[model samples]
Target chain A: MTSAPVYLVDDDEAVRSAFSLLLGTYGISIETFGDPAAFLARAPKLKPGVLVLDLRMPAITGLQLHERLAAIGCDWPTIICTGHGDVHACRRAFKAGVVDFLTKPIDEQVLVEALQQACAALDMRAERAEAAHLVAQLTEREREVLDMVGRGWSTREIAESLHLSPRTVDTHRANIAQKLGTTSVAEFARLALIGKAP
Target chain B: MIAAPSFEPASPRMPRRLAFLRSSAALAGGWLLLVAAFGLYAAETHRRALEQEVSESGRALQRAISQRVAQHDAHLTSLSALGLAQAQPSADFDLVARSILRFYPRIVAIDLVRLGPGGGVVSSARAAGGTTADPAAVSAAVKNLAAGRAVYGADARPGHYRLMKRMNDTMAVSLDIDGRGLVEEDELPGWARLDLSSAEGPLLEIGARQAVPPFAARTVEFAAPIASETQPLRLSLHRTVTLSQLVPPLPLALFAALSLAALVLVRSLLAHRREAALARAAAEAASRREALRQHETKLAHALRVNSMGEMASGIAHELTQPLTALLSQSQAGRRIAATGGLAGSPVDEVLAANVLQAKRAADILVRLRAYVGKSAGEAGMHDLRTSVSDIAALSRIDLGRRGIALDLDLPEAPVAARVDPVEIEQVIHNLIRNAADAVEETGRGDGRVVVTLTRAAEGAVITVGDNGAGIPPDILPRLFEPFFSGKPEGMGLGLSLCESIVERFDGGISAENGPSGGALFTVRLPAAGAIDEAKEAVQ
Candidate 1:
């Protein structure tokens, strides 16, 4: 799989440039913006990325930007950085669903580690979205068969409950396996849970 | 900060001086009036005594003159009886007449005359140096003579008078008497004039006439008639009273001296009382000035503390950006080196960037130091105990109003340090205010702020602690950093400014959780003598 994209937003040009250069040495390419407004304007069109945002910005703080993005359903993994880190701000960032909080002169290793973690969380969310999308394409009868199977129901019980013959239940199960690419009950149960998540 | 109280002493000096002069003048006037009254009374008494003496002397002299005139009548009677008994001109009558004349010196001549057809001297006698009697005087005396009545005629010569008595109608006796013999010379005082006069005019005058001055106060005159019926003489005595006698010099001098002394004594007492009042006013003014000076000192300290917070916060915000850039750049350089990047490649550019950022941050710090640092004031030796306690006392009222209790624990002996007193007070006040805020945050009724001053081997130590929640261990390390605040609305530079001011004076400050689980801040400053010793050692 391709590496996750990274975006950095900060008001200070020098700080943004320095952070971009530092992270570039570790083979992480960063797209930088001088203000939150610029980053917010391009946020919806951009691909899913790890957002490196400065907490204190001119019109919009990192937390506020995070909230605005979440309102528009652009829930990208975010890491917050501040020149002056306070506990209250840290707690607020965490409560706002930011992936990590860092203070400036941020340790390069620590930033890289936090970025790696955020990338892993993005990958996990992408896999979950892909599973949910695949589940959305299944037929209504197949969904019902899948739901029962996930509940640990037997084919005979499911056929009896649905007023279907055992051969037809077998046919619907085969269609479910072909569409989901997972015939294991545990994989079916995980896919069912993923589809059920809000 | 509190405004100074107003106190102005009324100016009583001019009015008091006027009052003193008024009272003194009144006293002096009253004294003079009393002296004048006494002088008049004494002069009146002297005048009365002098009049009494003159009248008594005049009466005595008049009685003596009357008796002398009556003796002439007796001489005339004896001469007439001798002539009448003889019945004719006989040598025996002549002999008796001459004897009468010789016996009475005032009786200068004696005569017995017959009247009606031809009245001639039947018997006559003359003194040895007496003037001869005039026939017209004899005739006039015979016409006026009455039975058993002696009549005095006018002056025969200059000072002689005649007295006649009629035995019968035709036979009468007459005698010539000298009026000058009626009075003695030494009977009158030198200041008096005495004159004896008959019905016609003045007879004889005795005593020298007194010269009356124009301004004489009074004149005394005594006049009386002689006792004898024949010779009705008037005796008059005159005396003039002078101004000097009315008011004597000796008593006036004494009274003037007494009044002056009394005035001087009263004036001195008034002056003493005025001086005491002035001294009291001066003392009050001095105390007021000192109170005003203290109030100004407190106000200055409050202003310095507030401005220091503002300046420090601004500097902190400005310095943060460059410091962040420096950290990132250096880390970038380190990463490139660890990856074995070529030294002459991007490493040089990264290193140059790091140096640039470092220099930028250092320049910002230099500007901040100049803004709120050592140039603000000079340090001086001060007792930490007094300095801490003074600020504590000033804040106590405000703390008390907010339902907080502040306690002080200062050593009895002085803890001296070389630091600016105003700067030190500012630090103490800031810490106390922070402690009060912390205690108030707990919302406990029994909020207490304790300030303690003590001397340690290192230096003078001052500790300010509160009975509130202790500082969290996580934030303790960053507590003194500029713009790092636990409070929401704080500029977050009070503690940092305190550190700067304290460190400028060669002092150190630390924060810890006390035994009671409350935040405690301790400041240590080098003692004045200790600093001197260190300087000597360094030299």
Candidate 2:
């Protein structure tokens, strides 16, 4: 698995650099931007990373940036960090797909945990995309066979359930492994669990 | 030395008090006039009534006197008839005189005389008592005898009179009547009288001799002929009626006294009403002023608290940046030191930067405390320049947020004044905030507020001027009045409270249009040294 850097966007240079240093001590890489405008200018080149945004800035607010990003279909995972959070602002952050909203002088443990959670959620989304692609390649009989095998059923049981011969079920299983590029049963079970586009 | 005239404003209650006094005086005067008029009318009415009663009594007395005299005349006529029909003896005449005198109290004597050949009286009635007949009397008797008539006269004595009738050409009969008895019959208590007149001017006068003024005493006169038809003897009765007889004096005096007392009562009642109204108005004014004072205090406190809240948030924002910087630098430096990859200069630099940022955060907290923290507010000498600078520093964050520039024009030397430092700072802060608001309202770019402190004869003057559209003409008068606001969000007590605080320090505050444009507010406070000197002089 590849780890991505966290992007920190804030109007205050001190806050941006401080957050970069704080997060860097925990072995997390950070990219700092002085304002939402500068961050947006570099947004296209950004890889899948967590966005740590300050709620208030000079040109535009963090929430407004989130709205812009949503309008542009930039669905990067987000963690909102700010000095103040009224209920309205918190609601807007959640609506903007933020994983966590933290107020400053932030607790280091809480920030690290929120980052880990955001990155994990991003990883899960990427895994779900891969699983759906692999599942789309399978034939209908291959899908039924994969589902049954992932359930820890025997080949004969899978064949009876599908009303097919055991030999046919084995061939379908082999074809599913080749199509998914994973011959490991554990990998197949993982794919079968999240392969329904959820 | 020529001195300018100082005009002191009249008190508000003056006109009403004056009007009350005028009306009260007029009412009192009118009351006295009414009493006097009624008293005069009562006295006149009483006197007239008394005069009418006295006149009636006088007429009745005249009738009684005539009746008594007529009875005496009848006796005299009988004596004359006996003398004329047959020569009567002296004893017969004497008997008749005694009988006449007994019958008429008015008559005291009677006489019979003979006029021999020449109408000379040869009279014998108790020897005539040396009352000789005059030749005129003899001729009058002969003339009366020729006419067959009787005569009466009053020239005999002080209170006596005589009546006679011709018995024949040779004789006549006579009687002398006392007039004093007539006075007794007619005289009443509290009244005077005069009796009949004969040859004498007046037969009798009774009562006091001194004349009474006409209106003060009521007089009645009655005149009636008495006795014989040939004698024009008249009974005259004079009755002078005094006021005490006509009307009792006590009730009239009581009525006058009561009227005067009632006048006093009505006047005092009106005066009391006026006083009560004045007192009520004064109390209402005082109460209204007190309520206004309370409302102003509440609004000022609320504005101060709310602004402090907003400043606190700004402080959080302001301090957070430095805190964040300090945290990040120290953390970065620590990580580098733990890794053994820290270059000496770089690590030291980061730590130094961290220290600097931490100090910056601390400085922000101190400023925040100075701006919003409560203090003992002990009045003492304060450096005006320092207060202005402190307020300027406190207001910088708000000015920056609003994109306004604050210009300070304070003197290099300290301007010392006597005031509570916090309160004075707050007043300056309020003025700055108002200036910023005025600038903000203009919506002009690069809004500027200039704060200047200067020394004046009376005190130190702190002026806050803003480059904005000047205050409107209509609201200028009410600018320092409580609850008068130009902004929709303004509590409007800022300037009013500032004025009050300044005045509490023996100072004043005023606003005016700057020579250029915009609004300028000036606060004046007494110099601390000058106040001390004044105190010393008073001591």
Candidate 3:
């Protein structure tokens, strides 16, 4: 699975360095910036990554930056790190689609845990795209049979519904299962429930 | 009570002491004058009375002695005349002379010398201790008698103050009183009246044998002619007396009376004046004592006070901040664990911050507990933001009261100072209140209190300026002295006390007419926390 690069934004030198080092220990890549202005300057080229932003900064604080990122339609997953936390800032961070709100001087273990969860969420999103690619490779007739099978239709019922032979419907379902990497029609039905292409 | 001097000076007793000395001198002078007058009168009367008594006795005694001598002369003449008239002159001259001599022992010699023809001696007779004079002396005496004159002489031969009177009588007889019994006088009165000597000089010639003190006598000599037929032109018989004597008793009585009267006058007048003078002096002394008591009472009263010194309530309110902050610092630190800031922060760093805040609070407490740390906790090398914010916090009520707007001009640099911060806030509060009051007094509330804390190389200066009535020309001089209030309800001690606290911490506080046409109080405190070093040695 591909990992999302974390954009680490903090003002305290020691805190930023320590957090970056812990993320590095977990083999997670981090891009650190001192202030909101610095982060916003490079924001356009920023790829999909988890944002680790210090909540308090002198000019254009963490929440404001989070809002700006939202306004810019930047859809990166954000995890907020703050020296001090208030209910308002936490609520605002969450409303800005921040995945986690953590306070510093951060615990190495908690930080690593939060960052790993954030990365896994991003990896799941990438895995769904790969599953869609495989689903696109199946013939249109095979997709029809897979859908009916996920609906708990018998092969004979799918043949009668689409006006095809029962033998032909069974062969389409087998091809859909092979393409989606499911062992049986039941597993294929579960993959389709997750909106996975089969 | 005597009235005191109108314009009193340091020592009210000065006048009383002078009065005492003046009256004392007058008393002494009057006493001396009275004494002198009385004594002079006494002395004059005493001398005059003594002189009168002495002179009268001397003259009377002289007359009495003269008469006694005359009687002796008459007796001798009677004996001689009985033998003379219509009968042959048969009276023996020797018998007459001897008889006369026996009756008078005071007479040392009696010579019966007959006048010679044509005033020369006819016969000469002498007593036992006497010799007949030489023929020349007898002849001289006969010539003097023929010329009808007496010869009164001092003793020519040793022994008497003698006078010879050669009288024109029937016979020339010589009488001499010797001075052998009259020497070494026992009394001054005898010296005054008599000179009985066998010598003659200024003193011896003064008297003849008339009277004498017992130890001394004087002599007079005389010669006259007798009534014998052979002695026709010579004078012979005479006697002389000495009048050296003691004081006569009668006039001394009158002299004593005169002296007594004069002495009484002297003593009485002197005593009266002395008493009067002493009374005057004592009265002056008593008055002086009273005056001194009054002056001492006045001085003693100046050194005491009756009531407590009053200060403005506004200043008292301002003074409580650092004290409150010092108290709140620890109390605020206790609320820390509840906030959970410690979770990510080092425990030691948090603890140290708490300690530092406590130290700050403690420093203020100790500094203030000295006289009064009557400053707000807003000043010093404060984070400029905190300093500005604190003044705003403290002056809120004052701003509301005046209906005035307050603009705080703060610099970003940390304006550390050695100052009474609370006092500076109070000064600001007062200025703002004054601005509001000034506007309200005139029915205008557009007043503004501008508090400015500016930094220069010299120090940090805080000015609280207002657009109210500027300080009057007369009120400016003592604006900083306690109890010099301007408002009717004002205790007037606020600015003065503020200036005191500010100056105590080596900061300067002053008031003036602002360039913006209002009263301005400017305080300049040394920045760099310069006076904090001074605090290490304090407390």
Candidate 4:
């Protein structure tokens, strides 16, 4: 898999640059913005990546930016950094779906680990999207066969439940495999769950 | 800010002395007048008693003399009757005449004379050492026989008189009287003089007259005619009332002592009242001073708490940025070194950046320590314009973060005052922060704060105002009261501390809603010269 992109936003220039350089050494490429405004203007065009944002900033806070991104249908995982972190803000950030909350003079390893976790979450989202797109291509009967198969039903049971011949259920399963590119039952179940996710 | 009440110590001595002197003079004058009145009354009473005594004594003496002279007339009439019964001179008549003379010693002599030429050979009688009547007495007797009435002849001798009576126009009887023997020596007082006189002249005098000092004695006299048919006599008594008699020493001494005691009592009462008044005044002054001292102590404590709070928040924000940078750079350097990338990588640059950040954080700590070093600083003459501008510059950092614009309008000329620079800074900082908070509360996009400094008549005038929702009328009056807060996280000592610090240097601070709908705070400081003058005035 390609390395996921990372973006860091902080109001202080030195803190921004320091975080960028530190993350770069850990093989994490980062784009830095001086303020939340600059990061927000570029948020729309950004590919799915991990967002590392300062909790406190002029014009917008990290949590507010996270909400704004979610409003625009950009569901990137976020890691929040702050000069002074409080429990309420941390709790609020988590409630807003932020991956982590960290305070300044932050432990570099902890930040890197949080960023890795965010990157993994982003990769999982991308895979889920691809799986949902592949599931959309399946014919209606094939989708029903795949659903029954994901539910651990045999081909005869599927045929009996649908009032079709077992031979017809087998053909529908073969078509689902060709469209979804996964013949394994676990892959089938994963794609089935992805297609059903809200 | 509330001005400290001034108290002048009560000066009780001068007025108290004056009051004491006034009362003392009144008491003395009153006492003297009272004593003089008593003396006059006593002296008048003594004079009246003396006059009464003299009158009574003089009347008694007149009665005694009158009775003695009437007895002589009886004796002569009896002797003439004896002569008429015998028709010639007889021993019995002589014996009777002698008895009469002996019984009444005032009659020194007795004689019986014929009215014709034979009257020269008339019978005469005398007491033990008495002498015969003189030729004048015989002539007077003969004259008395012709008139048929008895009369006393005057000036027979000193204190002596003669009385004669007619016996049927043939003969007359005569008696020589001793006037001095009529009155007893004990009948008159030692201070009195008595005199008896006939129609002719003074017949007798008794009781030696005493010499009285002029203007020092009161004289009382009693005079009356003696009640005697045969003799025309007047009796007079003279008495001199001396000073010692008129004003008795015992009562006068008692009165003087009472007056003196009253004067002392009144003077002591006045002194006691003065002392009580002085003590009360002193106590009041002491209480006032103590109250003022307690107020000052409370104000100082509040100032300390407020400054410390501001310092804590300022240190937190100021140190965080550099610390964040330093930690990041050091961790980055450590990571590069562990991977054996230090020699040729950006490790040197990272280490240098870490040092710089550490120094930046240290510099911030030093500034905060200096700020918190002195809780109470010495005041000095400082230009208000510079202080206002400096505070404005400092507040802009925090205000800008909240998107509040802070502006300064400082005069070119210096506005100077005697003030602790740190405390003044705290005042300006509190005002600016409050203004920013007010502006932010409104959440206006164009929130602005303006701090203006200008020279004023008193000294310097600093006005900090914000274009935001003005303060509520109910809260405005209590804005500077300690422990009154409008914000959730406020300790409520900011504005109160500002007032205390400003007023400490003889300056004033006030808050009001601006005309254009914002909260405005004005601080006025007395000029350095004015403060010095005030100090001199106090001294």
Q: Which ten residues in a row are the worst by lDDT in model 2 chain B? A: B1-10
**Model 3, A43-156: lDDT tens per residue?**
988787777776645435577788798788665667886533234356556755788897533345566678788888777666666667776777777767777788999888
Ranking by TM-score: 2, 4, 1, 3
**Fnat scores for every prediction:** 0.47, 0.38, 0.00, 0.49
Ranking by DockQ: 4, 2, 1, 3
Candidate 1, residues B1-539: lDDT per residue as tens digits?
22223346544364443364447567677667867777878888888888888788777877787777777766667767776777788898888777767776667777777765565767677885566555555666667656666677787377777777777776777777776666655655677777777888877776666677888887888998888777787888887778787677787778778767876776776677677777888778778667656865765665565466446544655566667777777778777776785565677667767756665665565466445443445778888876776677677767989999988888878888998887788888889999999999999999999998888987898999999998989778667766778899987678877876786676778899999988999999987777676555434
Q: Candidate 2, which CAPRI tier?
A: incorrect
lDDT (Cα, tens digit) per residue for candidate 3, span B200-239: 2432333343454454322222322222222121211112
Q: After superposition, how far is residue B306 of candidate 1 from its true place, in Å?
A: 21
TM-score of 2: 0.42
Please name the candidate that would achieve the greatest lDDT relative to the true structure: 1
lDDT of each: 0.76, 0.70, 0.54, 0.76
Model 4 has a DockQ score of 0.20
* Model 2, C-alpha of B373: deviation from truth (Å): 7.7
What TM-score does structure 4 among the candidates reach?
0.42
lDDT of 2 by residue, A97-186 (tens): 678897655545677888889899888988898899889888887887888888889999988888989998889988998999988888
TM-score per candidate, chains pooled: 0.37, 0.42, 0.28, 0.42
Quote the positional error of residue A138 for candidate 1 in Å: 76
Which candidate leads the pack in DockQ? 4
Q: Write the per-residue lDDT of candidate 1 for residues A1-198, one digit (tens) a residue.
A: 238889998888888888887888877878899868777888899888888888766445688899998887779899998754444466657767898998665656687889999999998899899888988989888889989999999999999999999899999999999999978999988888787537
Show model 2 residue runs off by greater than 4 Å. Answer: A1-11, A20-103, A113-198, B1-96, B102-105, B109-178, B185-204, B207-317, B329-539
lDDT of 3 at B158: 50
